[model samples]
Target: MTTSSMKRSQPFRSLVNRLLDHGILPTRKLILLLAGGSVAAALGALAGLGYALFWLYNAFLLLASILDWRSMPRRGQVNVARILPEQTDIGRELTVSLVLENHSGQPVPYRLRDDLPFSFERPPDVAGVLSAKREIVTYVTKGSERGLYTFSHLYLRCQGRLGLWEKQAKLAYEQHIKVYPDLSTVRGYLQSLQESLIVDGKKFLLKTRSGTEFHAIREYVPDDDPRYINWSASARGRRLMTNEYRPEQGKVLTILLDCGRMMGVELDGRTKLDLSMEAALTLAAVALRQGDQVALLAYSHEIKTYVPPGRGLGHLHTLIEAVYDLQSDFVESNPLLALEYLHRQQKRRSLMVLFSDMENYLLEDQLGAYLWRLRRSHLLLLLSLADPLLHDWSRTAASNSRIAYVKALAQRFQLDRKAFQQKMTGAGIQVLDIPADQLTLTVVNSYLEIKSREAL
Candidate 1:
C-alpha cells in the first residue's frame, strides 16, 4: 500500500506480465468438461443428430475458454519476494519465507516452487488460494554442504477465473547464502564456560595449582587446597577463603589446517576435512576466550588461506569468513611450504596445532626435519583423526584367511601410528590421534593442558 513499495513492485510486475505471456496450460476442470462433452456428442450421434451437436458443443467450449481467459487475473497482479537468511550452518535448519501481495481484488489460486540449491532438500510445491491483500508462506530447509549457495527464479502458476487454464510465470529472484561449520560445540562451551575442567562430556570444579597467575579469591570449600588458603582475606571476611590461580593467557595459537586429498576421506557421512575445521573452530574459540591471539593457516599443495594473529571475538569472525568456503583439494599437502611460510611471517614463539592426516605426514619423509626445527621455536601439536573402521577391523576375530589378513594390516597401521606418536612426544612435540566425533574435545583439552604447563 505504501508508495515506495508500490514503486518497487512496478518493474517486477511488468516483468511478470511479460513472462506470463508465454503459454497457458489446460487445467483438470477443463479436461473433464471436454470429456463429458464428447460423451454427450456420442449419445447425440446415436440419436441421429451427431454433426450439428458436435459443432455446437465445440463452439460453446471455445467461447467459454475465451471468456475465461479475459476474466482471468494477470500474473503481475500478485507481487512476491523471497526472504532468506544471509548465512547458516551446515546441517542447521533455516526458514525461508515468500511474501506475496495481491492487488487483483479477486482471489487467486496459485502454486509456487523455489529454485533451491543442490545441497538442500526439494521442498514440496506450495499451493493455495490467496484472497487477502498480503500473505506470507514459509518452508523449512537445511543445507548439507558448507559453501556459498544461490537461490534464483521462483516458478509460479495461477489458475484462470473459470478454472480452465493455469498461467505460468518464472520470476527472477536471486539470494546468496554462506554455509559455515556447525557451531554447537562452541555454543555448548559458552553455556558451561564457568566450569573449569571439562572431561569426557562431564564438568568438574577447577583445582587450581600453584605457580600460576591468580584468578580470584573465593569462599573456601571442603575441596579447596589447604596450601591456597588466604589467611588475611579469611580474617577480614570472617570466613575461610582461598586464592584461585588460572593458567596464563595472551599466548599465540596457530591453527595449521591441511586441506588435501587425505582429508577428503569420508567418515560417518562427513569428510575428515569438515571434522577438522569444526575442531579448529572450537579450539580457536577457546583460545580467544582465554585472551590468546589466534592465527589460522589453511593449506593443501600451497597456502590457501592465512589469517594473521588476532584476539577478541571480532578475530573469530574473520577466521570463519576465511575458511567457511574452503574445500579440500585433491593433491598432496606440502607441509614444508607451509612451515617455511610460517617461519618467514612469524618469529615469536607460539603453539602450533596442525590439523592433518597422519598418513599424509608419514608419507612425506622430508616433513619430519622441518617439523622438528619448527618445534625448537614453537610448541608443535599434530592432531590427526583416527578411522573407526580401521580400529574395528583391528579387533575383528580372525576366523578366515581374509579376516586374518585385514586384522593384521590394521594392527600394523595402528602400531606404526602409535610409534610415530611416541617419537613426536619424545621430541617435545604434542600429538593427539582422536576419532572424528571426539576431535573437538580432545583438541581443546590438549590446548588447555599445554597452556597450563606454560609450554608456550
Candidate 2:
C-alpha cells in the first residue's frame, strides 16, 4: 500500500513505528517528578547515601516515564480533520476548525499546530483534552496575499495518561483555500446608489438629451430640454409635456487590467495592480447591476485572462474567480496586443476602460494613434494611479540642489501628464489620473456619466 494508504488503514502499526522511531518528550509533570527526586536524593545525602539514592530514584523515574509513554493511545486510535473556508477576501479573518475524533476508549490530551502558508498570520497553538467521541478546536487567521493557499500536515502531540510524556504524530490533512481582493466598497456603492434614487419619495430621473429610448411623458419643467417636448401629448393635455428617457441598458463595458512590471510597485501597502483589481471588480459589479454586459482582459507581456462580456450579478463571481490569483508579470505589458485581441473578440461598440500606468503609456508614442482609432467605434477611457509621492515632491520647496532637481523632475512629469490628458481629450479619449483610494468611486462615476451621455 502507499504511504498515505498505510497511514489510513494501519494507523496502529504506524503508531508502533512512530513509537520506535520518535523520541518521547518530557512534560512539565515529568520535570516536576525529576525535581522531587533530586530533593529526595539531597535528603538521602544527609543520611550519607546521596549517590546511591540518586541512582535508585533515577531508575524509578525512567521506568515510570517509559510506562507513561506506552500508555498513550496509538495514532490509529485518533483521527483529525481540518475545516477551512473555500474562499475569503484578503485581510479578512476566517475561522479554522480542527475536528478530532478519539476512539481509544479514554480521554486524550492533545496539542495541535497546523502547517499553514507563511504568508498568513501565525495561528495560535491549540491544546485541549478530548474526553468525548468528538472534539472541535477553532482559531482565527487571515491571509495577506491574494492566491490559492494550502494547508497540509497537522502536527499533533498527545500526552500520556500519567502526564509524564508526549507522543508526537503528523496527520496528513490537506485543504485548499482561495483569497480574493477586498471588495468591501462594492456594497456601499450599491447602497449609496439606491439611496440617491429615493429623495423625498420621488425617484430622481436621470435626465439626458442623449438618451434615445422613450420612457414616460411628464409635465414640462422650467429646465426640461426643449428638444424632448412631446407636441402631441402637450396638445392633447392642453399643457406643456416633455418626454422622458432612461439610459440604455444591456450596454457593453470592457475592463482592461494591466499586470506589467510597473504595476507591481507598492503604494500604501497595496500594489498598483491590487488597487486596480479592486476597482475593476467594483466597476464590473456596478455595470452588471445596471443590466450591462461586462468583459475583462488582464494582460502583461501576453494576455493572462479574457472573460467575454456577460450579464447578471453572477458574472461578477466569474470575473473574481478568473483574476483572484493573477499576479503582476516581470515583463512589460503590450496594450496594443490586448486591444487588438479585444477588438476581434468584441465587435460591438463598447465602453473600454484601461487601468494601467501613465508613464508606460507615455513611453509608447504609437499607442495614442491606436487608442484614437479605437475611439472611432468605442468609448475609450484611460485610468492611471497617480502616485502621491510625486505630487508631494512637486509641491516641496527647493531646500537643496538635490531637492530642486527632484522637484523639477516631478513638475516636468506632471506637465507631461497634463499635456497627454489634453491631447487625448482633443482626440475624444477620456483620461483620469486619480489616487488609488479614489479609483473605484471615480471609475464608477465616470461610467455612469458616460451612460447618461450615451457616449457608447
Alpha-carbon shift of residue 212 in model 1 (angstroms): 2.0
| Residues 1-456, model 1: lDDT tens digits | 999999999999987777564457788999998888878789789989967787788788899999888766785888889999999999999999999888889898888899899999787898899889999999888999999999988988887678888887788999999999987777676566465746446543333463388889999999668999999999999999999887777889999999999999999899999999998998898889888999999999999999999999789899999999999998999888898999999899999999999997778898877788888889899989997978999999999999999999999999989988898888888777898878887788777767767767
**Would you give me the overall lDDT of model 2?**
0.87
Over 4 Å off in model 1, which ranges?
1-22, 35-38, 197-211, 238-240
Which runs of model 2 end up more than 4 angstroms from their true locations?
1-23, 28-47, 189-210, 214-244
TM-scores for every predicted model: 0.90, 0.85
lDDT of 2 by residue, 1-456 (tens): 798987787878776777643446788888888888878788789999858888888898888888887889886787889989899888999899889999988898988898989989987799889899998889899999999999998888888788898887777888999999987766555566552433223333333454777768999999777988999999999999999887888899999999999999999999999999998998898788778999999999899999999999889889999999999999988999999999999999999999999988899878999998899889999999997989999999999999999999999999999999999999989899998867876787788778888877
Worst 10 residues of 2 by lDDT: 198-207
Best by TM-score: 1
